[model samples]
Target chain A: MAKAKLDKEKLLWMYRMMLLIRRFEERTAQMYGMQKIGGFCHLYIGQEAVGVGTVAAMKKGDYLISAYRDHGHILAMGTDPKPVMAELFGKATGVSKGKGGSMHLFDNEKGYMGGHGIVGGQIPLATGMAFAIRYKKSNQVVVCSFGEGAVHQGAFHESLNLAKLWNLPVVYLIENNRYGMGTPLERASAVWDLSQKACSYDMARATVDGMDVLQVNEAMKEAIERARQENQPTLIEARTYRFRGHSMSDPVHSHYRTKEEVEEQKERDPISSFQAYLLDKKILTKKMADTIEDEIKKEVMDAVKFAEESPLPSLESRFSDVYA
Target chain B: MAEITFREALNQAMAEEMQRDENVYLMGEEVGYYNGAYKVSQGLMEKFGASRVIDTPIAELGFAGVGIGSAMVGLRPIIEMMTFNFSILALDQIINNAAKLRYMSGGQFKIPIVFRGPGGSAHMLAAQHSQCLDPWFCNVPGLIVMTPSTPYDGKGMLKTAIRDDNPVIFIESESMYGFKGEVPEEEYLIPIGVGDIKRGGSDITLVAWNKMVHVAMEAAAILEKEDIEAEVIDPRTLKPLDEQMIVTSVEKTNRCVVIEEGWPYAGVGAEIAARISALAFDSLDAPILRVSSEDLPMPYAHNLEKEVLPSVDKVVRAAKKVLYI
Candidate 1:
């Protein structure tokens, strides 16, 4: 609601949310190595600010859909970490009741539609949700997030065209993490600026520094307002980097950028930069930051314990939910 | 009661349902303004307006996923596939997303959508256009597959499918659109997963569906002069098959013959044969014989196409083989 300044508590809360996502993803990476979380697992270690800032700009009842690298997105949308961790552990208490693992986390009650697996699969679904919102004359906006690689998919182009043609209330967020499973954006995309791809559909588009939480939040605010007010659609390319490999199986150093490149990106870590901003502005003291770190560490540990103790889905659970 | 063509029945069903529920709308290529590719949605657009009867681009995958997404949030969308053959471009969305969305989300949302269009062999349309894709969709869970034969069944089943809170694959025959039948003027709905015994007899049992039902009836009529009484059964819904009705007919006839327009290897007929073997193995007099189209791409030549499709003679031959008459 406010254009510029926020109170001290809100800034600290945003910093703490980012820290939670960072630590949660770190634990998930460790769990993957230990074989506790099986199957394709993508970590959101460095892209927490994109989810945190975008979610901060969304209101209740606004829908969100994203690609496989989505743990941070749902967590930043105020979903409890307990079920998310339990889902990775394949427990019945998980958000999808152990049916959907890391790639398909869903919670309708929170308006988090899904974390779809196939590349660009959720684009049209999110566009259709915007259609539903418009048909019902509801002021809710739908935000769709996907990787730069998905820009090459037919669904991406078709959905964007329909969104603009119908003037649906939706925003397309492209988290440009430089590489899509070892292929750099330069090698994959003919156009260096991914946001301009929206130009073909006559839609509003922008590119922002994804590492800056405030900048991302500001961009999301404008996009969401435009969608809700004028029924316009926007495509925003958030320039960010993934600190980890594409997935757990990918080797960190071989056939891709060097270790130096990763370390260089770490210098611009979104969480570290945001924490420094708060301290510099006197909104947070050293002792207060230390206390928040301790609290988040305990929360992460509790999540792990909860996942370890949760029960696996029952045998009959397999037959249920096939139809409804 | 009124005598109406299958196309008019389909149009009336959609118009009635759209009038009943504001959430029910149709979206597909040429469904609006152009009425329909086959004129099955004629005059409904002028009544329901453009927002309700939407015309979409040739992007099947895109619009299909959009329909699934709208269904997730409580809007009932009927997505016409133009034709079942064109649905191949949208198979990823229909099978991967529409069929799995509910189960993958742990039953958090119900996809109340229908993907309907003409299917099966239609004249000399050749390989690409003439395809019966019921087997491909029937094999998937979280979907109800329905094939309606007559005007009454077409109107009633489409109405039920629109109201049902699940994804339905409604397959119709392009050749049978002009076939006329009596439909009640009063409101009515036909429940899915029910089979109809079109004509009852006692010597042998013949199972068929959709347009093939007419062929089965012709074959049965030809066999009647030879003193071989035949009972023709149409398992209208293929997925939730009326196994009890089929097994009962097999028990009484002591022989079975399956006919369909699709290939024989893995089709609805094959599924029916397997079910008869599993459920009524003890009641059989001979091995169940199948009458199916030759396993090759549909040829464009009229004579070759006629030879490729199963005819009344072929069904009679298969029936006599099981009957040993």
Candidate 2:
């Protein structure tokens, strides 16, 4: 593929965003260990490129919905980290008012639809949002993201068929991290190549290296443009890896895979690789990289302090928001 | 007042709402050119265009979730399940997504959508197609369940449901589609959680809804011949039930009998019976009796199907049992 022609400022912005996610998740894991943050917390350690690249390709007013592993997506969309960290702390000032933990972050103002808990549940909802955009004659599009395991669900097949049949404006993004909890994708899926499954619906398909932010952004630009201009739906598979376990309960290297394999995968970490790319391109110097690191480290720590001091949700709030 | 069939009343409710709000649209199998599986949405495609009256593939979960997704972004969608039985395929979207999005999202999103269709035994649809699912939806916290018996209540209550800012399960009866009743030409909206007393009496209070309300009326007529006046009360909306109306009626008559078309176990009748017993224990002269469908899956044979459902004779017997005569 030809060189991505991104400017110096945009490339540096992507680097900072990826580093911020890495630091935020590291602190989140530490908080989980201290028992300050509870519930099923899934970390996005090695898959930062997919979330950052895809959100970079999107424009204002575009909507996004993702599965349980969604802290990276909302953060990539420029949501304040204080509220997100507070949400993980289950405090009243959180983005979802502490109602939704790590898996259910929602920032409606940014068009970040939700952090849905179910595997394939958000697929049809994204298709419906595209349908609404068409119904209202709006030019906006919707991006629906899910893990590779969600591809086996009925909601995935059903949604792709409707999106193609109606020519709805949507992009179905699959972040294939190679495992669904302890089970590998090869054992779970009938077809190893997930993009081939889109052929059943005759929808457009693309694949990108999830560790390379530029390649993923290039693919997303083309797919999102197709959706916005032609009202077509595309299924883009980003071959990525999650360095952490499925949740905090599971270890990084379990019986599912060996410890050496986890260490080897870390060598291709999205954040480190992107930093190398920026350095090789002469767009970022060692001094600039150190400055970005220090800024992000302070920001992550302040978020931790904000979350630690935040109050738990009031008891009366439990009954509110159940209707309307 | 204009006399119309139950189907026409429902059609008017959709058409008027669609005319009032551009965000309102209808989607389902056979809803567009097919004119709806049961013709409840007849002529909608022609009036509102295909964009508004959408016909979808036979994927209940897909279209149901699509309606909810649209509702999340400020669209009022009336999703028709070919039958309430088919809605079982989409229960996850309804129960988990639509019902929980508001609370889980901390009120950032409100799902103003409706899942409406005919429920309960209709002909010999067998065990699969024939079911009364009001209790299933009523059991959920975020959903509002409505079962209107007459054309007037059908039109008025559906309009109310469409305009309300909450997810609604509006269940209609297949057998009552052609049933005629008086409905005003002017616009009207019935508030949710209010009960209507269809008949007034002093001997016993008969509680029922949807098709069972008619059966309760028939039972009341039979009890009237024996000098035992029975008051028939229909709680139009099941979830936010009008407990005050039923409690007051039971206090006046001092006797109660609840009837329903669903199975006896955990049915809506059971909930109402429990509520009346709890709230009107001091006023009760006798224990409350419930007449419900036999605790079995609907059988295909005509005789067995009739035997499994709640009938006027069964309701009359339950009322007489409560009256101790």
TM-score winner among the candidates? 2
True contacts kept of each: 0.77, 0.86
In terms of lDDT, the poorest run of 10 residues in model 1 chain B is: B89-98
Evaluate candidate 2 and give its CAPRI docking class based on DockQ. Answer: high
lDDT of 2 by residue, B39-90 (tens): 9999999999999999999999999999999999999999999899999999
Best-matching candidate per lDDT? 2
Question: TM-scores for all candidates?
Answer: 0.98, 0.99
Instruction: Report the error of model 2 at residue B171, Å.
Output: 0.2
Pairs in clash, predicted candidate 1: none
The weakest ten consecutive residues by lDDT in model 2 chain B span: B316-325
Per-residue lDDT of candidate 2, residues A166-283 (tens digit): 9999999999999999999988988888999899999999988998899999989999999999999999999999999999999998899888988899988888877887888888
RMSD of candidate 1 to the truth, in angstroms, is: 1.6
Error of 2 at A61 (Å): 0.5
Which 10 successive residues of model 2 chain A have the least lDDT summed?
Answer: A1-10
